[model samples]
Target: MTEDASPRALITGGSRGIGRALAAAFAADGYDLVLVARNEERLEAVARELECGYGVDVTTVSADLTDPDALEEVYERATAGGAVDVLVNNAAVAVYGPVAETDLEAERDQVRLNVAAPVELTKRFLPAMLERDSGHVVTVASTAGMRPGPFLAGYHASKAYLISFSEGLTEELRGTGVDATVVCPGPVLTGIHERSGRGSRWLERRFMRSPDAVAADSYEGIRAGKAVVVPGLRFRLLPWVSRLLPRPLSRRLARLIIDRGDPLESDR
Candidate 1:
């Protein structure tokens, strides 16, 4: 399709990491873009990069999606230009310390960004997609959602909520041309861990997939109308393994993997 006639994709957190990669992927696939992020400079940089590189139209919205008013503004701006044929809810935050040690305010913000933002955005944008009878919703969840994670309890739980919400929404849109695909990626070499003040460099190097690889898998899975997209071979097996193991054993394994250091280190 020509650029003017191409579909448009609105990707949250589009200024960096998986979201940025997805923006490039969609642009290359002939889609115009609405890139949303909190940093205007970064958003503009990404928009210019995509437009210059792929010769596709690009719009940038700078807003903190955790704020209700900011999120509404994003919705208005996104729809103001044109219909968004693909909605990629890729924005999220996480708190990685023990629940008691983590700041409650920070954890609340994490839930707001990771769970509430996507849920509300999906609810608002889905009607237009259903009316058009053609749209795609891709939510970037995590393998952390598949099972209980001790050290990162709040983050994992928030992602679990997103995964469940996307799965149910996908089934609800069965006959409609609109579709929802939740992507569950394991560790990724992104600034998220650094920002969260958690994650070991050693563990990240061992298990993390590249952002580009994750984005490519996510884009292809959404195109194929898959309900769940796990980006790598090891991550793809997580849900199955979680399901097979007894709940207590699974939780223990999750704790071991997530803690990263001696549990006593937090007490020191």
Candidate 2:
């Protein structure tokens, strides 16, 4: 594609982790980018890196997605340039620990960022895509959405909403030349877990997939018009196995594996 004809992708949470990786993947594929994130410094840095390395146009909008007004500003900036051909809803927050112990405000923030943000952004951008009869919507959900999560209750529930929303949108857009895809990745080696005070280095090293791999797989799946993209063989098998097991058994297993203290805790 020529410079002016190249497709543009608008990615939320594009400053770090899977979002940053997705920006790189799209840049490498000759797509210009509009990166939205809370950290202005980080967003500018990433924008420079992608432009310098891939020779693709890059735009950055710094805003906290959890805030409705700030999110609207991001939407305005994203569409000001032109209609985005691809919208990647990757911004999310996780509040870890038992429901009773976790702060309700934090949980609410998680829901706002994880659930509402994507829905609002999708609603705003999808119309233009449908009008043009061409576009892709990619939501970054999680494997935790497949079943109940005891400790990270709110986060899991929010992700479940995203999974359902993405699938429904995909079906709705069937013949509109627009595609919607949800990427469910098991434990990724991102700062999200650490920042949320959930999981451990040992578990992450043992089970987590790299952000780059997850982004690459998600991008490829979206391009192919897949409704769901679950990275890693283990994770891809999780939903099926969870469905085969009894609900109570599945919940018990999840609690034992995820809610319990870290494996290295005993040693420490």
The CA-based lDDT of model 2 is what?
0.87
Candidate 1's TM-score reads 0.93
In candidate 2, how many Å is residue 83 off? Answer: 1.2
lDDT measured at residue 60 in model 2 versus the true structure, 0 to 100? 94
lDDT of 1 by residue, 38-91 (tens): 989988988999999999999999999889998899899989888999999999
Summed over model 1, clashes come to 0
Model 2 C-alpha lDDT per residue in residues 1-268, reported as the tens digit of each score: 2246889999999999999999999999999999998889989999999999999999999888889998789888888877799999999888889998999889989989999999999999999899889899999999889988888888889999999999999899988889999999998877675577765546556886788988888878878889999987778898898789898998887787666344332100
- List residue ranges in candidate 1 displaced over 4 A: 1-4, 260-268
lDDT of 2 at 213: 87
TM-score versus the correct structure, for each prediction: 0.93, 0.94
* Residue 33's lDDT in candidate 2: 97
In model 2, residue pairs whose N, Cα or C atoms come closer than 3 Å (at least 3 residues apart or on different chains), thus clashing, are none
